[model samples]
Target: MTSRSSWNTRNSDVAWAKFDPIAYVDHNYRCIQEDDAEILRIVRDHFADHFRTTDTTGPVSGIDVGSGPNLYPALAMLPWCEEITLLEYSPANVRYLEGQVMSYDANWDQFWDVLREHEAYRSLGMGPRDRFCRAVEVKEGDLFDLARHEGR
Candidate 1:
């Protein structure tokens, strides 16, 4: 079997985002079904329990590594984390994330509904899109460069 890495190396420059940003958004994040809501609820419930007794007032930070234009994972961290740094390699994805922060797709509202159910988030006064945008910071960088080791 051919290695996936070799195949990706041969086709890495394909302009997935350059072709059409809106279409990309439409295909990926715009579709929200009941299954997605259930998954979001599971994640929210887990984190809500994890941070229940934890002090949320402190400067808690989280890094969403390789955050390929997805916002829900960062939203999941909001119960405890005050600052979320979204590190991604794709410039197009970075722009997409920034745009979503300013004005999110309507589908994201369902995920927020799950998050808002948590009292921890409610106590923080983080109502919705604006608060989520304020919490996120996008940085462009490769995950490999972030490895903590001398040779890595």
Candidate 2:
């Protein structure tokens, strides 16, 4: 089993320690530009209810467990949750996610466009990338250490 501190140290043994953020985006996120209609449909269906109401009863907070350098999955949760806690095991990935939030990257445009293509999201007429950066909060934590990460 992976120890709690194993990823904390970012040991070379950890496969994710060598993760490449730009390459990851190029490989995964750019697919949205290719064809995101189906993706938008699925995610929109999952999160459509969250946008129907403007009250506090809706999902107020959500967590991205083991979030790597990927941002699309978090984008999928954007409409449903007000605050998204990005829990990452690798320090490298944590820093990467934090950097993206601190400064929105232009490369993510395709991903945002894909999300915005949905009628529900398109109606917002707002910048999805900017909104995503604002809503996300990065936290470094262990995925296996149930005691510490359970209620976070």
Candidate 3:
């Protein structure tokens, strides 16, 4: 069989650009399911444990590759990062993310509620949407391109 790369030479967005960001949000993130909650707790604890010991002179920056319509990743990292880049390849997702950062939809509050079960997230205080909007920026990028430079 031909290599997958040869068959998919076109830009990644060629297909993903058709993805519906809002529909995805409605379907997956409208509520925090049990599995999502467990995963969020695991990730929050992991990041908190790592960052708690990380020696930093100043603010920390983070990146969430292929962030898509997911806000939970950014929310989990919100406490630790001064700035979080939500990198995505889909044009539809890029627009949706930009819009949310401008004025986040309230549906995300439930996700924040779950994250705050940990002290690290609770310390950030109320108004998670506003806080998240302030720290996050949406960017259109290719994860594969970044992978090409995995090592110096």
Highest-lDDT candidate:
3
- Where does candidate 3 stray beyond 4 Å? 1-14, 147-152
How does model 1 fare in lDDT? 0.74
Off by over 4 Å in 2: 1-14, 31-37, 49-59, 123-126, 146-152
Estimate the lDDT of model 2: 0.72
The clash number for model 1 is 0
Index of the highest-TM-score prediction: 3
If ranked by TM-score, best first, what sequence of candidates would result?
3, 1, 2
Question: Lowest summed lDDT over 10 consecutive residues: which window, candidate 3?
Answer: 5-14
Ranking by lDDT: 3, 1, 2
In candidate 1, the residue pairs with backbone N, CA or C atoms under 3 Å apart (3 or more residues apart, or in different chains) clash, namely none
Residue pairs of candidate 3 with colliding backbone atoms: none
Cα TM-score per model: 0.74, 0.70, 0.82
Tens digits of lDDT, candidate 2, 118-140: 66666644567666777899988
- Residue 105 Cα positional deviation in candidate 1, in Å, after optimal superposition: 3.0
